[model samples]
Target: MHGPDSLVFKSDRPWPNARLRVGAIVGHATSDSVRLWLRTGGPGRFTLLLYDCGEAMGSSSVRAELRAALGRVPVSAEEAAEALAASRTVPFEVDGYADDTTRVLDLADLRPDTRYGYALHSEDDGGKVILGHNRLRSFRTPPGEDERRPFQVALFSCHMPYRVSGLFRKRTDVGDIDAWDFLAATLDRHRDDLDVVIAGGDQCYSDGVGTLDIWKLLNRSMRREGGELLPDERSMRSWYRDIYRGYWGFEGVRRVFDAYPTYMIWDDHEIGDGWGSHYLADDGPDDGLARVLPDLADRGLTRDDGRRLLRRMFRAACAVYREYQHSHNPPTDAGADPDADADADAERDATGADTDAQDVWDYSFTRGGAAFYVLDGRGHRDIERDGYRILGEPQFRRFEAWADALDPEETPFMFVVSAVPVLHARSALANADLAAPVRAAGIGDDLRDSWEHDLHDEERAALMEVLFRAARRGLRPLIVSGDVHCSAVFSLTDDDGHRVWQLTSSAVTYHVPRALGWALRFGAADDGETPEGYAFRRLALYTGTSYALIEVNPAAREAWFKLYGKQIVEEPGPDRGRRAVPLSHSVAKIRLS
Candidate 1:
């Protein structure tokens, strides 16, 4: 029941000065380095103390030590004090311009496959720690690249926090169990086994601009006489910040973020529902927000005015997104140096087909024997101005280079993350021509948001060709995705047996309606062939709130995937009304070799 303003301490030593409410989130991690994101009450200097548990400790022992450090177990005062006195101290500062309350601390030069407990404390002007009560959290560094370690990762997305109508104060969705609560419980039960957690997309929905009070005001303002007097960039930034803080402040969600080295990428909902998939002009038939607000023109808002407002909203969204999500992700080439190659970057931008590496949100990283490339599907999408592109030319070129440079002997496995599924069901309803009509009915943008849509055919072909080429070179390329509100597996196999797989798990917290579930199942029930003559088939489909666990055993050249969620029982039996039981179903097991 703890809110954003509440602080949970690891001990009850009664420290009156420990009043600052802070949130510690473990960000991207490597064998020797890890990033810690902290959100404090306000801007100030702080010291982070990291204590490494001895290498002799086993996984079970490490967990015990962490529990004892958190005051969950009985530990003598002598042991606790000794551990704290032997910690490594690092000082950092947070400032107002950078969103006063948040800062990211990068710690490097740590041992691989090591467990470490950490605590954050506020400091006085004299450089002395002032916080008396602190919360101790811990994370384990991944095994080094040279090590052949068997690791498991959890992947899921579409986290819609339980929302209440701001005007009515009532629930908007079904009430069962919180998905984050289930995920936190699962993490606790298998803490030692899970190495990383990937939140594929839709970490928080900005549908209707969010559920906060400011968002409600914005919604009402949109329906006013002009519908053009929207919140300024500053006001929009504060509202978006409130949305993130409110949504992620739940105890279970906080626990999951703090417990693991989690990575994330943005999808459409992170900006607005179907942000990049529709026409931008208000007068166009396929216009997105115009369709949502059909009377904008009648309300005295011109097409140009609407377009300007959309651009403003986009700017605000990107500003807040960088501060909350992208800051902790690995930096892009252009982002590393904004001034580097300015002339070249400007030349590329003039073509409307190029993007600076920094402007693009795409990033890649490696763990052990596998490499991951997270695509910025929404960030650079341009269906209208560019005549259709999911990943702009520059970002796609970067992806091609990454794939071409991979040495199969050293890294045989590659995971391509497209927040949206690349090979989902193919249906006529998803055609681009039907976008206007579909959107008029309130679901058009979603139908057009797929890789199979006609608008993205060329780009999808290019992406698939690169993956196929990688597979031909003996690299097992697997695409993992979310945002479909269902769990499914698909594969493309050529005559020579060069195969590529796609795994999708989504709606970690949001529920999929029954009719939509049936539609998804029916659409994915068939097999087809790509234009390149490669056979593609849907292997499995589960429509529910679920997450996928992938276990990679590099030594054996094998990987196994398991989807965990509640299974539906159709039979009218005694178990029909019984308590829901979470079950793990084997989805796929593939050989990297």
Candidate 2:
């Protein structure tokens, strides 16, 4: 089978000056449309040619035609041009200001359940195509919402890229790329079967304020007073841009992104270790900033200064996130306005103090018999506020409305993506005010980040009730999550026997220590009951670099979740090089009706 890597078009002509930094990533797709995201080396006009895989053509025949058009099977430039001209063409422009030339192009009016092969070409100022080598990326538009068909969705999260400087460091040692390679191979093997790929959270870790270079840069910019010397907006944006590029630029990772329609939501690590959960005041008891920089007090950093710094960081992080990640997501309530000014809509306050209704990141979509609601757990989170909400009031209300409106007859399976698991082992340590102790033990703000954390108990209960209500109404609710660096399946059952499942696939690249893995397993081992009398228990668990495939068979009225873990094996070849392969770790089937 030809993987995404083999689809690259080769030519004797010199490569164009304006090239792709990250490969074309297929994102958020509906039956009629799909979004494609790309980052170029510089600002330029580009045209994407999308060729349909004819209904009568088989997979082999389609590949043969693609190869012939690209000259691999002997075709002239004119013939290739003619073939490409027969396909649909979309023209777009990229600018330097938008996260260094990143753009998301939405292709509309596509045929449902159809496969399309697309090639991107740089265009001249006169609107002529600049012919050169480019990869042929493809994605299949989802089946119509009314259609009840079998489809699969891949879920995973918590991607931490390897760092050479921290080679011996425990964290760095476990940050391997093997999982991504395995994921690429897995997606390629099941290309036709898999429809959507959902990255639960922590796509890239901005841990410890990012890499050594970023740390040094931030440190150098910090003043003793932490007033005037805080890193400027440009510096912060540059640091985050570098982090995203470094983490997502891996060859295997790019291949998977290029091949599938992916959806993503950010976790705390996207901005900092525990962005919304930590105290912002320097003198505050649980101030994560003070703990990370123990000498901040001695350096004369005050509470106000810390607040200002954090605000600046948040603004920069959110701005860049919107450009890189949020651009491809389905339009939000506020973002759906076609007449809204793009620049004005992108701007958010430094503190995020106001509930900018326009800043809503949560979105929902339907495919076949399933409905997916991706909650923005990190964006509007307000642990320091009086309400201590996770999704904040505005987004929470939107979610509630979406849940309330779901029709079991139309969408039998509902998946709620929370990034952090909604149902995990209850953490006793998280209930207490042991922030100082936990920080001393190098856990950072993790304990506070949990849904079980005392601060978020109310919000967690509210979310659970909503899911339970959905289940009672006959919708099979499954909460998909990541960020704990472990994989597990948990089910919540109400008195009426209504069930909701939590499927967690995490640390797609990062490794989990044996002790940590065992601890997670043990904590989730015991069955327990929620405050509302709903019993919950761990169904299956796997601690490793892994991902989950949820296959929905609407005709069967059931879904099968198979967790695949990464296993390193030596290839049987002359070089005898080792490679990572995916091995089935666990499987569970849940009834849809």
- Candidate that scores best on lDDT: 2
RMSD of each: 7.6, 7.4
Candidate 1, residues 1-593, lDDT tens digits: the string is 22122112223312212222468778889989898877766666667767765654446765565445534223333344454663577767766444637777888998888778776656444333222223346788888888777888789888764544446643343234456776777676667667778889988766522333333334445422332244344445555665566556566677788878888898987777677787776455666766544555765666555554455455556766776777777765422221223233233333433232248688899888888899998877866755437788888999999999998878878999999888774632333454454435555466577787777778888898999999999888999999878888888888888999988898787742423334454456457786567787766777767787888876677887777776544546766664454433433444333
Candidate 1: worst-modelled 10 consecutive residues by lDDT = 1-10
Worst 10 residues of 2 by lDDT: 1-10
After superposition, the stretches of candidate 2 with alpha carbons farther than 4 Å from their true spots are 1-20, 55-85, 124-134, 164-175, 208-216, 224-229, 292-301, 333-358, 427-444, 511-518, 568-579, 583-593
Each model's TM-score?
0.80, 0.83
Give residue 546's lDDT in candidate 2 (0 to 100): 83
At residue 197, give the lDDT of candidate 1. Answer: 86
- Best TM-score among the predictions, by candidate number: 2
lDDT of each: 0.66, 0.68
